[model samples]
Target: MAFTCTIPAVATLQQDDEAIRITRWDFEPGAVTGWHSHGWPYFVVMLVDGTLRIHDGEKATDVPLVQGQAYMRQAGIQHDVMNGSPHPIAFIEIEVKQPAALKQLAA
Candidate 1:
């Protein structure tokens, strides 16, 4: 298993329709999300923003995360995350519903 940033929610519903789940993730400098997959295609919108260093197992790069910006990711893309800021980092993760069969793929 790999290390991943913790998901924090002080309150609310864990699941619902639209098959979409939104989450607020915060990370400090050197923070990282272990290699993992969403199991579904989804969108990501940066909220309390910062920069992130993304690792795709094969390569790594830095992506600037700014407020009000959104990015779409392929379902089950195994990648790692890292905080590139000295301060805390935060963002909104929107998960979309995907069929179970398609979720099980080799990364």
Candidate 2:
């Protein structure tokens, strides 16, 4: 997917160690995170209630989120995310570096 988004979202890296990587993403209304793919599985925790316009390769979809809401996606998800809400939005993204090991620990 091609994104002509001139206003890009801001990503603040909180941590990056052997086991995990953490980042906080903040976006103004109409801001976007240009098309990219994740190298590891990740979880998103919403800090502000808002809607995100997700652009998959083929089409765009709106995902409504509530404050404190959380969701996870696997690696290699190629997509673009835009702040669909009229206000600013922020979310914390925790990317698991060793998903297999984490799963083993849960077993």
lDDT of 2: 0.92
Q: All candidates' TM-scores?
A: 0.72, 0.91
TM-score of 2: 0.91
Task: State each model's CA lDDT, in order.
Answer: 0.70, 0.92
Q: For candidate 1, lDDT tens digit of each residue in 6-40?
A: 53222233454656676677676777766777787
Residues 25-47, model 2: lDDT tens digits:
99999999999989999999999
Candidate 2 residue spans exceeding 4 A from truth? 100-107
lDDT of 1: 0.70
Winning model by lDDT: 2
